[model samples]
Structure formats: structure tokens, C-alpha cells
Target: MAQVLFLGGLGRSGTTLVERLLGEIPGVCALGEVVHLWQRDLRDDERCGCGERFSACEFWRQVGKTAFDGWDNVDVERVQALRDAVERTRHIPRLASAAKPAVDVLEYASYYARIYQAAAEVSGAKLVVDSSKHSALAHVLRAAGDIDLRVVHVVRDARGVAYSWTKRVARPESDGTDEMTRYSPGRSALLWNAHNAAFGLLARRGVPVRRIRYEEFLADPRAGLIRLADFAGITLQPTDLDFLRPGHADLGVGHSAAGNPMRFTVGRLPLRRDDAWVRSLPAAQRRLVGAVCGPMLRAYGYPLNPQETR
Candidate 1:
């Protein structure tokens, strides 16, 4: 069985950064957001972590050949539509107990499982880290029962997430183009609550899950990684967290399908908190986010008021 670590949470919660850090460890391959493989990477021809277009990259070419008969036989549009129909947030609860999943779910899971198997084979890693950040997909994979799936639910303060989503950050693609992603505070709060709740449902349904707060992980990454390794049934060596230099780690190439442009980042991962929102976010917007996410925020130990918390 392929040992898979599925990152489940809302986007911009440091999933990409954690994935990269975990990838630096020996015997682990971080495949960033394989959920976007059919749509963004293959159909849109996005750049891979290794700075090459998906079709042109030798590593992913092998993955395609190994996972599917060949890349040419895969219908990107059809698969993407199927994913939208079957794997969605609203459908997560039902899929969690879907002993006999819909044909679409089964088909997608088969294709996805092949990718995980191929990744483990090609990278020769004992574990494959998939930072897909989708609770629905996580539940589907768990129901499929084709691979050993473990989840690391990365959560961030909803206020911080709302602030992060409001900012316009550019994607670091090779083409010098930018992928601008922004969300209103209200939408961010709703998603933060809903995504976390969905993942919680999976845990209730007996999925092996480890919940990690982004702030706590940043406070002590070594400890956080130790807990994660323990949950995934892997042993961590001290050398894995030993930064070669300030902000630098000896990371290997991974053909992650899609994620923040940070996937293209190699070496020197600076660990610091992005607290700009506390200083720059407007008071009304902050309060609005607090109102929407306050109950869960407090449950996760985030004070409704940023001043009282961090």
C-alpha cells in the first residue's frame, strides 16, 4: 500500500510551505495539490515545481506514462468535469460513507491512486505528501480504500486567513505571468469554517487525522514535524530539520501539479509568521471575520480579538 499524507484545510493556511518542508526529509516526496493535475497543470499547461511545463517535464512525463497508459489518452476536460461533479465540499459527508461510491468517484479515485503509486515508485520514497487541501477529496480517497491515507489538517486563524485572502499575491510562474487570487473577508471566513468542519466530519468517521495549527507549527516546527511523522508512522531524523544555512534547506525536485508559486522555491525556506494582517486589516473587516468564524476560532484557541491573542 502507498503511504499517503493528505493535507486537508483551506488554502493559504501554509499547506504549500509545510509540504515543501516535509519534502526535504529523506524518503518523502511532496506532490503539491495533485487534485489540480487534470485541470490546471495538464489542461492549462502550468509550470511544475521544477520550473518546467507539465508536459515537457521528464519526471511528470514518466508519471503520466506510469499512471495512465500515456498523457495523450487522458481527457483533461472530461476528468475535470467529473471531479467538479463528484468531489465537492457539499458532497463530502455522503462520500465519507460511500461504501459503493458513484462510478465517477471510483473512476477518479482509480486514476488518482495510480498517480500516488507512480509517484512513490518514481521517487523511491516511502511516503507521498499530497497538499491538496481538499477535505472532500480526502474523504473520497479514504472511502475508496485503495491507498493508506493519513490526513494533516492545517488550520490558521480565520482572521489571518481572511486577511491573507484579501491581499493580491502574484504567482511565481516561469512565464513572468501572475495568478491573482483574492477573496472577501466574508467568503474567507465561511470557507475557513466549512472546510475545517468537513475535515472534522472525516475524523469523526474514523479517518486517521492530525490537526495542526499554522501558528503552533511555526512556533515550533520541529515539534510539529515530530507529531506529524508519528501520525504518519515514519521516524524523523534530527538531520531532516537541520537547516543547512539560515532560511535554507536541501530540498529535492518534486513534480507537484499545482499550488502557490512557492512550489517553485528551492532552498532557504524562511520560517516566520505573516502577521501583517493584524496591523493592516481594517477593524470592521476583522470584526466581520470574527463574527463569522468566532466560535470555531475560539475552539481552535484563536481569540476573537487579535490583540488579545497574538
Candidate 2:
């Protein structure tokens, strides 16, 4: 079995930057956002950290065609359709946990083993990083016995994520229909709640998990990278970080907004905590978030207004 690591968190929680940083380490191949659910709509020019779409990129094309034994033949639309059919048949929240007889643990494990072999052959790295960042997928992957699995559960403050979401909603190029459709602060707050809650619950279940806060990772990338490398049993070199920059030049987007490759660029951006939600969200929206996600906010260390939630 190959060494496989998963990055789990909600969308827009700095998973891409973490994946890119990990990709720089020798013996690591970070497959960005390989969530099978979105494989159908994934376009060639779609701006992934890899700088291309999951389907059209030469790297992924090879991974699907050769490494994973012709996953390229699986037909993205067909897979997505099956998933959609499943979702249609059940409540949406249960989509993550639903068992699929078509793509059970063995099939998934075999497919990913092929990917690991492919990645190892291409990069000469012994470990593969799958930054799909989905909790349900992580659960499934862990159940697969073909790989040595470890998890890095990354978390960011709810308000910061909400602010970023608000910005994306305004961007003509952003694919944030959910954010646009549900323009309320509670959405972000609830997202924060759902992801962190998922992470915590998963971690508590005896999975091999290392919790990493985005703020802390930003403060000390080298140390963080070193710790992650140590956990994955890989050696790190300074040159690998610099050389990998060209491959990652267009890497940052969505969650990886602060894409500067230099390790010390963490402080280049301000660390405004709650202002994005406070300043940008209307009073009504703030109340909405407080009303809905307030209990979760407090449980996760965010203080709430006295009147909003009990």
C-alpha cells in the first residue's frame, strides 16, 4: 500500500495553498480538488492550483488514463449522473455518507493505488496528497485498506471565510451560485460550523488526524511544512520550495488567495478577524448568522451577541 494523505476541510479553507506547499516537498504529488462529484463540469481552462482543468491537464490526463487504469474511460458525466441520481433519491445532507455499490471501498482503493503508483513514477515522490478536502470522502478513503492514511484537518475563522465568500459573489468569474443565491451571513457561519464540526467529529473517531489552523500555518509555513513532512516521513529541502514556484505560478485562486510562494509572505496581508463580516454584512445578515449558527460559533470559540442564540 502507498502512503496517502488527505486534507479535509470545507471549501475555501486554504486547502489549495497547503496542497501546493506540500507539493514542493520531494516525494509528494498534490492532486488538487479531485472530488469526483465535480469531475463532469470540470473544464480544461478551469483555474485549478495545477493551472488547468482536471480533464484536460496533461498531468491529470495521464493520471486518469494510465496511473488509475483508464479512469479516463469512466466517463465523468456518467459518474456524476450516478452521484446526482443518488442525491436525488435521498436527503442532500446524507449524500456524503451514502454507500455506493458501484464504487465501493475496494474499487476506490484500487483506483487510488494506481494513482499513487503513477504519481510516484512521475515525481519520484513516495507520498501522494489528495486535497479533495471533503469529509465524507475522507471517511470513505480511510475505510479503504490499500493505503496508509493520515489527515490534516485545516480550519479558518467563520467570519474570514464569509468575507471571502462575499468577495467571490461579486466577481463575475466566480462560481459561487450558492453564495449569490443565499446572500446571508448565516450561510458562511453555518458553513464554518458544518466543516469544523465535521473535522472535529472525524478526528475524535480515532483517525490519524493532525489539526492545523490556517492562521498558525500562515505564521510559520516552514515549521508547518516540516511538521507535516515529518508526519508523512519525507525529507525537505530549501531548493525544492523555490524550484516548485514556477509550476505553481498561477496556483492561487478561491481559497488560496494569498498564493505567494515565498514562505515568509504570511504577514503581507492584514489579519483582520471579524471585520469582513461586520463591515461587509448588513445588520440583518449579521443577525441572521448569529441567529442560526450562534451556538456553533460559541462552541468553536467565536463569541456571540447576547440576544441572538441561546
Candidate 3:
């Protein structure tokens, strides 16, 4: 079984940056958003974080061949249909309640198992980090019945998340035209609350999970990496992490199947906080986001009042 450190959370909560930091560790291989690999990598033939189109990327080409004999053998539509059927956020409740899932759900999970195991084998990694971000997918991975699954729930301020959703960021992995999806403040708030709550339930259900708040992680990312590495069962000496001493890291090359455009970034990346949302989110939307995410916001230790941005 593959030991997977699954990064689960609402989108736009800094999961990509965290994943990149973790990938720098020696024994961990980061597979960005394997949940989206079906549509984004295999179907659309998008660019990998390595800057190669999916078909041309030697890493994933090997992962496919190792898992399924070949990507050609994959039934993309069938997997996609199965995903829509049982892998949705709406299905989380029913999926979590049952020990056994329907035949189709099991079959959908089988693909995930193979790919993750194959990724482990192909990369010869001690741990595979999948930054899929959908808390619901963790349940599906659970159903796969053969993975050593662990979850790291990444939480960010709902207001910041809502504000990020309004930005018009381009998806570089695409044909250079399509942009990342943007959501209204209300919708983003609702999603933030729902996903965070779902991950909390995952912990109660006995899947080994550790929670990491994005703000605290960013405040001291070098320490953040050590804590994350410890949770994942890897130890790092101070020398192993010396690269981050300058308050930045020249990130190593990565081949995420899909994630924030930040996945494509490498070189001397500054470690700094992104509080743009704190300043730019309109007061009205801040209030609206606050109302929708009130319970979880306080639960996660965020101030109710979005104080004037510094």
C-alpha cells in the first residue's frame, strides 16, 4: 500500500505552496491533485509542472505504463462518469457512513490506488504527497481499500479564501486562454466552511489526520516544513532545511497533475504572507463571508471582525 499524505482543503487555501515545500524533502514525491489527473492530465493533455505536456512528461508516462500498462488502456469517460457518480462532495455523507461502497465506487477507487502505488514505485519515494484538496476525495481513497491514507487539512481564513476566489488568475497548464475558476464571496465562504468541516469529520472517523493553519505555516515556513515532515514520518536535520534560512527557497522541479499556477513556479521563491484579500476584499463581501463561515471561522481561530487591512 502507498503511504499517501493527502492535502485536503478548499481550493485557494495555499495548498500548492505547502505541497511545494514538502516536495523539497528527500523521500517525498508530490503528485499535484491526482484527483484531477483524469480530466486535466490524461484528457486535456495539459502542461505538467515540469513544463512538459502530459503526454511528453517522462514521469507520468511511466506512472501510466506502470499502473495501467498504458494510458491508452484507460477509459477516461468511464472513470469520469464514476467520479461524477460517487466521488462528489454531495456523496461524502453517505460514503463516510458506510464501510462498504457500491461496486462502482470501489472500481473508481481502484484506479486511484493503482496510480498512487505506481507513483510510489516509479519515483521510488517513501511517501507520496497528493495535493488533491477535495476533502471528499479522501473518502473515495478510503474506499480504495488498499492505501495507507493520511490527511493534512489545510485551513485558511474564509475571508481571505473568498477574496482569492474573485481574482482572475490564468491556468498556465491550459492552452494559455482559460483562467482558473472564480467564485463569488458567498459561494467561496460556503465552500470553505463545508470543506473544513468535512475534514474535521474525517479526523473523528479515525483516519490519521493533522490540521495545519495556512497563516501560521506561512509565518515560518521552514519550521512548517519540519512539522509537516514529522507528521508524515520523516525526520529532517537542520542542514537538510538550510535552504530556507534566507526566508525563501529555490524550489525543486515538480510535476503536479493539476493545482494552483504556483505549482509551475521554481527558483528563489520568497517566503512571505499573502494578505491581499485582507486589504482588498470589499467590506460588504467580508461581512457576507463572515456570516456564512462564522462557525468554522471562529473554530479555526480567525477573528470575526475583518479588521482594516494593514
Candidate 4:
């Protein structure tokens, strides 16, 4: 049985760091956001953050070849056929295993497994870390019963999430998926609130998860990594600490190395990504977040400032 580790949480919650650290573990391949089926095309506009056009990235190309080989010979049309089979069926991944030629969800899982397997062959990893960050997909994998999975429930303050959203909007190649609209500061705080709340409830029920705070990770990465390794049942190397350092000189080529989705480091200044929300947010924005997320902030250990309260 393959072991799958999911680094799931809101978009900017240090999932990349977790994925990178896990990748360092022998036999673990961290495929950062390789949600191949979700996107329309591999060559579509979105960058995989692997320093390559996703379709053309050599590593992913090999991943597509060896890992996704079964589908590789299927041609574009066959890939489409597989995709259409998914769309028509009510259960996206449920009937995946039953797809024509008997492609089950495990095969789908295996395709990614191949990617990790190949990466492991090259990088000497034993597990594959997937940072898709989708709760719905997590449920689907749980249903498939294909791999032993552990979910790292990473979280940061809502304001921090909002701040990260602001930075993304400023970038040229951003996904522009209306995350702000989905969870607009005040009114949409439900998106973040419910997301965090779900993790809390799951943890309380003993859902085999480990909670990691973005603040704490940045403050003392060594402690965070130690706890994370314990949860994943892996040991860390002394060199692992070097990878978490400021300049990111430790990460080798062919790795994301402190980039989006699959990178991490302890910054020299070491500030929380959400810190700017306090200084950068306008009164209206602050009011918006306060209305929906005031209680959530307090729950997450933030002090309540009366002016920002509902």
C-alpha cells in the first residue's frame, strides 16, 4: 500500500514548507499541487511553480510518462475519454477505478504514485507528499482507500490569509479565482472560519491529523519539523535544518526551493505572512474581516481589539 500525505489548508498556510520538509524524508516525493485532472490542460496558463511549463517540465514529463504511462499511450483523446468518463459519472473519483480498461481510482492514485515513485528513484524518497489543499479531494481519497494518508492541518490567522490574497492579486499570472469573493474579508469570513472550524472538529474527533500554526513554524522551525516528523512517522536529518534557513542555499536544483506550493525557509526577519493585515488593511476591509472572523481570530489566539470587533 502506498502512503500518501496531504498538506492541506487555506492557500497560504505554509503548506509548501511542510511539503518540502516531507520531500527531504527518504522515499517521499512531494508533488506540489499536481491536480492533473482538475485543470483543462497540462499546458494551460497556470504555472506549476516547478520552474517549467507544466506540460514541458522534465520532471513532470517523466512523471507523466512513467507514473502516468498507462494513460500516456492513451493519446489526448483517450485522456479526454477518461476525463469525460469522470464528468458523466456522479462520483468523480469513485468510478475512476471502473473506467474502461479497468482504470480504477487506485490506478489514478498509482499514476501520481508513479510520479512520486520516479522522484523517489531519483531523489531516494519513500513517500509522496501532495499539497493539493482541497478538502473535497481529501474526502474522495479517503473513499478510494488507495493509500494510507495523513492530513497536516496547517492554519494561519484569517487576516494573514486575506493579506496573502492581496499579494496574489498584484501578481500578473495569478489564478484570479475570486478567493476574495469566496471569502471576502467580513462577509466571506465564513470560508476561512468554516475551513478552520472543520479542522478543529476533525482534530477533536481524532481524525489522525497534526495541527501546525504558521506563526509557530516560522518562529521555531526545528520544533515544528520534529512534531511533524513524529506525526508522519519519519525521522529528520541534521541537514534538514539547513534547508529551513534564510537564504535557501540548501535546496538543490530540480527542487522548488522556497517557491510557491513546494518551498520553505526560516526568514531572517521571520514575520508571519498575516502581520501585514494589521497595517495594510483599510478601515472598511478591517471591518469586513471583523464582522465574519472576529470570533475566529480570538479562537486562533489573536487578541480582540474592540474597534475591530463586530
Candidate 5:
């Protein structure tokens, strides 16, 4: 089994960036949102991170062939349905303790194992990063118990996440035909509570977990990347840190299956914290988010009023 660094968090909370950073490491391959692999990558034939459609991308085509004997042998619809049944928030509690799983759960987990193993073999990576951004799926993988998994629970301030979800950003991988889904502040806050709490529970149940706040990561990316790399069992060489020069990152292309539009962005990108929600989010909405997410917000060390927050 390949060592897996599973980035679990709410959507729009910078999992894509962290996953990309991890993928930049020499022996790490980033597979964007494996939870969406069946529907988004396999069925929809969306673009890969390297600018080729799924069917045409030699990397994923090889992954299919190696994992399932052939891509054509995979039943996309059946796998998608299995995902729905076994990977849901409601199933996490039971899954965490299920010594033996139902037949469907085992089957779903086997597919994931094969995919991760195939990805590692094809890319020649020691570890693979999966930024699936859901507690439920993390629970499923943890419960399945085959992969060597570690969770990096990325968290951002609820207000910023809510503000991000409100934006109508285009999904460039979808050929601009679709947009990222929007969520109201209330719904986003509820999700922030649910997702974070779920991961917290996962940790309490003995899963090795590291919590990274997005603000802290942006505060000093080099330090953050070093910390994460160490956690992922990779020792860094000086040249590995060369990509981080001054205040920017020199990013190269990858073959990620699905992620934010940033996945397609290569070359040097400026490094800065996006704190627009601090000044941009409406006061009432901020208050609403604070009220809904008060417990975890405090638990995660976010300021309630955010006087000088990033």
C-alpha cells in the first residue's frame, strides 16, 4: 500500500493549494479529489492538470489499465453509487468502529487502494496526496484499513470560507461550462462545524492527524511546507526548497484529475494571504457565521471579532 497524505477540509478552504504544494515534492503525486474520480474524471472526461482530456491523458489511462486491467473494465456508474452509500457524513460514526464492513464498503475501498497503488507505480511516487475535502470519505478510507493514511486537516476562518463559497468562480477544467457551487453563510458555517468536528472525532478515534490553519500556512509557506513534508515522511533537500524563492512559488504542471482552477495555473504565482473576507464580508453575515461556528472557531483559535486578523 502506498503512503497517503489525505487533505480533508471543507471546499474553498485551500486544500487545492496544499495538495499542489505537496505534489511539488519529488516523490509525491497529487491526485485531486479522488472522491470525484468516478463522476468528474471517468464519466465526464474532464481535463487533467496537464491540459489533456481524461481519455487522452496517458497518465490516467495508464492508471486505469494498470489498476483494473483496462479502463473499459471499470463500471463508472456502479462505483459512483457505491461511493454514495459508503461515503457520507452519516456513515462516519458507524464506519469508525465497524471491525468488518459490508460488501459494498469493502469493494469501494478496494477500488481506492488499487487507484492509489497504481498511481504510485505509474508516477514512481512514494506517497500520493488526495485532497478529497470531505470527512466522510476520509472516514471510509480510514475504516477500510488498507492504505497507510495520514490526515492533514486544513482549516480556514469560517467567514472567509463562506465568502469564498459565495463567489461564482468558473471551473476551467470543465471548459468553462460549469461553475463552483455557492453556499450561503449559514450553510457554510454549518458545514464548517460538521466537517471540522468530524475530523476532530477521527483524530480522537486514533487516526494520525495534523491540523493546519490556512492563515498560518500563508504566514510562512516555507516553514509550513517543511512541516508538512516531514509529517508526510519525506526528508527535504535544499534544492527541493528552490521552488520557494522570495515571495513567490514557481509551480509546474501536474496531472491532477480535478481541482480548483488554480490546478491549471503554472509558473510563478505571488504568495499572499487572501483576507478579503475580513473587510469584505458583511457584518451581519460575519456575526451569523460566528454564532453558528463559535465553539469550533474558538477551538481552532480563530478570533471572534478578528481585529487584526489575516
Candidate 6:
């Protein structure tokens, strides 16, 4: 059976960083966010983590040939449409249900399995780390039962997440042309709560999940990685943690299809908390985010009171 470590959570919650660090381990391959493979990488010809356009990347070319016979049988448009239809917040319950899924769901699951299988084979790794950060996808994979799936549900403070999304950071592959994603505080808060709740629902439904708060992980990444590795049924050596040097991690190449542009970063990844939101974000927006995500934030051990911005 193929072992998969599925990283499911909201964007900008350090999923990419965790994936990168873990991928540094032997016998593990971090296949960025394969969720965006069809639409973003293949369709838009985005740069892979290896700095090659998806089509030009030798690794993905092999993955394509391995998964779907040279990418000819892979209908990017059809799969993209299928993904959008089946992988939505409202469809979480259905995706996780014991009832038989629709044919489209099965087809998509099969495609995803093939991708994971090929990734494992091509990388010669025992475990494939998929940092898709989509809970619905995790539910779909768990329901399919084709691969051994484990979940790492990463969470970050709502204020930090809200602040990250508000910035207009440019994509590294954009060549100064593309605009990064930015969401309103209200929208971010609503989605963050809903997304975290959906993952919790999956856990209640018996998905093998381990939750990790980004702040907690940042507090002590070595311990955080050990806990994550334990949950994923992997072992980590102290030397693996040695990837950290003064301010950042010494990273290597990764071929993640879609994620924060940090996927493209190689070597010296700074390890630091981004608490500027607490002091820099507008008080009204911070309060708005707190109000919107208050209950869920509290459930996840985040302070909702304005006075406790820490």
C-alpha cells in the first residue's frame, strides 16, 4: 500500500514550510499541491518547484508518463471541471459519507491515486507528502480507500492568516506580471472557520487526523516535526532537524505544482513568526476577524479578545 501524508489546512498556515522540511527526509517526496496540477500548473504553464515550466520539467514529464501514459490521456480541462464540482466546502459531507460516491468522484479519486502512486514510484520514496491543504480532497481520498492516507490539519491564528491574505505579495513565477491572491478579513475569517470545522467533521467521522497549530510548531519546530512524523508513521533523526541554521532552513529542490511561491525557494528559509498583523493590521479589521472566527479560534487555542493580541 502507498503511504501518503496529506497536509490539509488553510493557505498560508505554513503547510509549504512543513512539507519542505519533511521532504528533506530520506524516503519522502513532497509533491507540492497536486490539487492545482490540472488548472494552474498544466493549464497556466506555471513554474514547478524545480524552476522549470510544468511542461518542461523533466520530473513532471516522467510523472505524466507514469500516471497517464505521457499526459495525452490526461484531460486537464475535464479533470479541472470535475475537481471544482466535487471538491467544495458544501460537498464535504457527501464526499466523506459511507454511501457510494458519484462516478465523477470515483474517476477523480482514481486520477488522484494514480498521481500519488506515480509520485512515489518516480521519487523512490516510501512516503509521499501532499501539501494540497484541502480538507475536501483529504476526505475524498480517505473515502476512496485506495491509498493509506494520514492527515496533518494545520491551523494558524485568524489574525495572522487574515493579515497574510491582505498583502499583495507577487508570485515568484510571475516575472513581475501576476498578482498574488488577497482576501478580505471577513471572507478569510469565514472560510477559515468553515474549513477548520469541515476538517473537524471528518475527524469525527473517523478520519486519521493529527492537528497542529502553526504557532505551536513555530515555538519548537523540532518537537513539532517529531509529533507530525509520529502521526504519519515516520521516524526523524536529529540530523534532519539540522536543516535549520540561524534564521532559516537549508532547503533543497521540490517539485510542488501549486502552493505559496515559497515552494520555489531553495536554501535558507527564515524561521520566524509573522505577528506583524497584531500590531500592523487595522484594529477594525482585526476585531472583525476575531468576531467572525471567535468561537472557532477559541476552540483552536487562539485569543479572540482585542486586548490579548498576542
Kindly state the number of residue pairs that clash in model 1. 2
lDDT of 6 by residue, 114-214 (tens): 98899899989889999999888877787566788888899999889999999998888778788788999899988899888888988887778899999
Candidate 2, residue 291: how far the Cα is off, in Å: 5.4
Where is the poorest 10-residue window by lDDT in model 6?
301-310
The full ranking of all candidates by TM-score, starting with the best, is: 5, 3, 6, 1, 4, 2
Task: After superposing candidate 2 on the true structure, give the runs of residues whose Cα lies further than 4 Å from its correct spot.
Answer: 36-56, 68-72, 81-113, 169-183, 238-275, 283-310
Candidate 2 C-alpha lDDT tens digits along 1-310: 6788788776666776677778656668776555532442233234333434434456655655666465545555654554344323122235334454235444544545666667656656688888767676666565566678898988765555665666633222233333233324566677667666676665655568887777567666667788988888787776655433322222222211112222122222232223444566566766676677667666655567533212
Off by over 4 Å in 6: 306-309
lDDT of 4 by residue, 143-200 (tens): 3444667778888766667656656332212454432223446534656775666555
Where does candidate 6 clash, by residue pair? 32-256, 65-70, 248-269
TM-score of candidate 5 relative to the true fold: 0.97
Candidate No. with top lDDT: 5
RMSD value for candidate 5: 1.1
- Determine the backbone clash count of candidate 6: 3
Instruction: Give the range where candidate 2 is weakest over 10 consecutive residues by summed lDDT.
Output: 255-264
Estimate the Cα RMSD of every predicted model relative to the unseen true structure.
Answer: 1.7, 6.5, 1.4, 6.0, 1.1, 1.5
True lDDT of residue 131, candidate 6: 95
On residues 1-310, what C-alpha lDDT tens digit does candidate 5 reach at each position? Answer: 7789999999999999888877888999999888887888888888898999989999999999999997889998889889888889888888777777778888888888889999999999999999989898888777556689899999999999999999999989766788888999999999989999999988987889999999899889899999999998998888887888787888898888887888887998777889899888899999999999988898899889867574
Off by over 4 Å in 1: 97-99, 244-252
Candidate 2 vs candidate 6, lDDT winner: 6
* Candidate 1 vs 2: which has more lDDT: 1
Clashing pairs in 1: 247-268, 248-268
Name the 10 consecutive residues with the lowest summed lDDT in model 4.
264-273
Q: Write the per-residue lDDT of candidate 1 for residues 89-115, one digit (tens) a residue.
A: 988867976667788888878778888
Estimate candidate 6's alpha-carbon lDDT, on a 0 to 1 scale.
0.85
